[model samples]
Target: MFVKTMRDDKLSLLLTLIFSALCLLTAYRSMSMIAEVLLFIVLGIVYFKKSSIKEELNQREKLFIFAFIGFFVSALTSWIVGSGWELRSVRNPSMPSLIDLDLPSKYLLGALVFLLCVRLKWCLSPKVFGYAIGLGAMVNGCIAIYQHYQLGYSRVYGWSGIAEMAEASALLAVLNLVLFVFASCKKERIFYFVAIFLACLACIFSGTRGSILGFVVTFLFVGVMIFWKKRELLPIFFVGVLAGGLAFVPSLTLEQRQDTMRFDSAENDLKQYMQGNAHTSIGMRFEMWKEAIVMFQMAPFFGLTSAEIEKKMPEILQRSGSALVGIKKANPNNDARGKKHNQILNQAAKKGIVGVIALLLVWFASFRLFTPFLNTSGNSLIFSFCGVSILFYLIFPSLVGEPWESNVTLPLVTLLICAFYKIQKGQKIGY
Candidate 1:
């Protein structure tokens, strides 16, 4: 009996480690998800007879699990109807999407791991996690900034395959600044401020329009909250300095400072090249949205299947404008190629009414979870900013970008849900 108990304990520890690693690594392969689920089962069985599950769950814990379940259910519903039509008449059968299956699997496994953490009282403090992520962002942002300057040997290097991934990560670093500035810890505000400033520096240099737009909206929302809360203006001032310092850097050898948004000028010649060589950058997004609308009109019910999306874009582009007729032959943004850029439009095209409704419900549920914190005192200011920042992403990301399946979007959603759950509990039940 002693030996058996020891072995069980070791297995449980191993499972816990595996789950944490999966979360950190963002592994979404089917095999990885299955292995994670099986390990969870093993741990569950080993602990089943030893302790009462009911005793482990509290109201706060229940809220977290329910919120995640709610998110998952919506995603699953969208996927089922969305993918079902395509699966009915398989043609090639060899090139099925690993992502289609892996996305849902990852969400389910992540929810399970998160719930287990809450139940086991292993939840990493948001402050710590936020700080660590913020620090990483600052470093990455600095590197991107260096790269922008075309610094010789001193430039920051990233894997060529994953440079775009840095875009979202850098944005998250900016959000962390917002998170930390609003946090109640009361002592680390200066450190967080510096981190956010560094992130902003990187943003100016990266020349990514998506991150730039996201940051502006996030900042405005955060600005309003800070002002309303009657908080000291010192931190905000520091942020201004950081942004200014990076923007006006005279030492930067790159021509980035000269290009600043004047896409039509000789100094910013890349914009013209983009316009001529790649009709599909931001320009293609506009055409795609119009095409997506026409698609919705054709299939108003369940929308278009994934296969249809894959098949139809070429014809749609031809009808909209031909390459011979002043239109570029190729799109610059690869993510926009298979997607409609707008999530709602994509849903309307992909799953019809069901997909659109499920997505609406998700937004509504997210807002509802965080509403209590919006009106309450104490951390109300910070929570309110965070809520708005998240909403901004939801509304805009779909409008002109397709970051729906990235690692950044999922965690940002989960973070909002977790915060809402915590604030709700702290109010009625007490933390």
Candidate 2:
């Protein structure tokens, strides 16, 4: 019995280490996938060893799991009914040609992870996870800063060489926000403070307007919440702000600052769109959103397939006189380049109202879990931060991209939710 218990503990430790690595190494999708597969294998073994499959879960957990499963089912149904197989090549001929199928599979994987964590009690130590994520953010942040120095401040990509600058910046911003909250709650950890500073530098250098806005908004909200509970920390917050501003001053050139602020005026963006100029970043997104809404209207319930969207986009553009003059004039074959930047619209375009409902349920369930710990103490504070971090990801991404489809964002979110659930259930996380 002693030997068996020790073996189980060792297995648990190994799982935690892999999970931590996944949190940090998300820039490499292949690596993250391999780690996730290994984790699932270990979880399967643990599940089989249990005397019974029954495990106690709160209502929120159950709802989240159900919503996740619903999302997968709805996505799969859309793929099948919408005849996704026939249009796979036209959608993306370069890859294996089953992008829609892959998305549903990913969703199922997340659901399984949530179930295993709840049933087998596989929640790892939050402190360990936080440190791992912080370290990862610091490394990525350093890379971004270096890139800005080496490649100029046009746009900086971190270790995630293939991902867009905005996507990478957004991920770092969310991770850094969590670290900031952890540092505030712990108060003694200089590691998190340094991590936050590095992350801020990365955000500034990346030159992604949405990411910068998200980081500022999230931290401002966190600061207010922290100060509401403990007003004495106000001075510390200001000092940190001063330090961050000083550190970032060198990189914040007039051109770079203006580039970041280019999309600030909504009225100007609309004017650019009305003039049929999709060259501007904000203008392109507005045009895409309009196209996405049209696609959603075509099949309000089940959604049009990727092939159908591809087939119809030209007609829609031609009819609306919004042919994305910049893209069309430059490369006629690449007219299908723009994507629905907003998550809700993206889902509505791909899987229709069913997909939208499932996503909404997932968001609702997430908040349901976190709402209780909003004003709690001790470990609950950390859990609340985790909740808020997830909320930020959900909210901020809807403005510019489909964050739910991201390999890094969704899995990390699942792991964090599971960890917080374990804490809420009074399970002692092993260090």
Candidate 3:
């Protein structure tokens, strides 16, 4: 059945569309287990088809190879650390068992499934890829509005831990907005503009500072590309979009404004700690990062075993003196209690220097694959936008949350990275 779908391009397109819609709806409904399972099933079916093996190892595949290496290494190290080191000295040894089961499994599954799709060329098209992400953003955006309707403020709406879901939705919104703007470059369609506008609007409501910054950086990148190509009229077109984008800012609720404003402030408790206050979330993250760096410094080569780091957390927290009593009170979901906001720092803390090195290699690999298109002179606007969008999203979000772990953004980044190479190389494979 899946093979039949693969053979029919029309069916493949339809599957992509339906899957896109399902992704968005899942966000709104908060059906993540179902969403993950359904996506896996669909991806599985697409790969099961024994189609043209020659088509498998295209530019897209090569790009994925780079990201896959990084993703695989990160997961492998995380699993090793989470299972061997982090779990060693836990209070209720069984508690570690649950983390060992869920955390690594999701990463492993996502990595394998994405690799299989690239091998099968499933969900590889720029158009379909854009639609899928756009749909997902649309769903989350609707969910944010819905949350505001029910609870009076916008927050993440899915099974993904609140921070992860919010970041993922924000990242996707940035990507979708870029694609939507690029799409506008070719044709003038009101529906396209409206849909993209709504998606960007949702991104604003998400209150994710990283995504907002990512969107701004993406626009700047687009401007550079347009200028490089001497496309003079693009600015007027973009300003119109910017105007529309700005119009929605004042629409945010008071609660939404307050929560999201923390994102804009550089004066979090960290500033107070530097002066003398000592009790800010920023200070805690700084403490975690410093302790992590010390652990890495001590075990620079093999890195501190995850077990060692886990055992040292209490001691580290105590020494840093960044502890707070009611810190957990700010969270409504209760899941935000213990997460380091930096992906790089998290990797260092868990996998030490070795993990950090592996992650850098993965970033290099992904960037290397896309370098060809970025430097090329053809109409690879979609591909260029994808690369820039991922770059900005990762860089900006690293300050806000550790999204590289278990969030949909990681795969989306990989997918876009793969799509850039695939679209460029696929064109030469003779249709």
Top TM-score prediction, candidate number: 2
Q: What does candidate 2's lDDT look like per residue over 1-431, in tens digits?
A: 32344356776578768877865765554555577677678887888887474477768778888888889888888878877765535456654346676666777887887787777744466567677767766776677767766766556665443234444444555555545544645553467667667766666666665666776676676677668765666666655555445536655566565543344455577787688666676787877777778778888887876656656766656654665745644543344333478889888888899989988988888778777776776666666666666576457756787767776556656665766666555433332
Error of 1 at 386 (Å): 3.7
- Candidate 2 local lDDT, residue 204: 66
Per-model tally of clashing residue pairs: 4, 0, 5
Off by over 4 Å in 2: 1-8, 29-31, 52-54, 90-97, 151-153, 161-187, 227-247, 255-275, 325-338, 423-431
Per-candidate TM-scores read 0.67, 0.83, 0.75
lDDT of 1 by residue, 100-154 (tens): 3444454555566545433431222334345554565566566656665566322
lDDT of 3 by residue, 54-82 (tens): 24455544554555555555556656654
Worst 10 residues of 1 by lDDT: 154-163
TM-score of 3: 0.75
Clash pairs detected, candidate 1: 302-351, 302-352, 304-349, 342-398
Between candidates 2 and 3, the one scoring higher on TM-score is 2
Candidate 1 residue runs with Cα over 4 Å from true position: 1-123, 145-170, 179-187, 231-254, 258-280, 311-337, 376-388, 391-394, 411-431
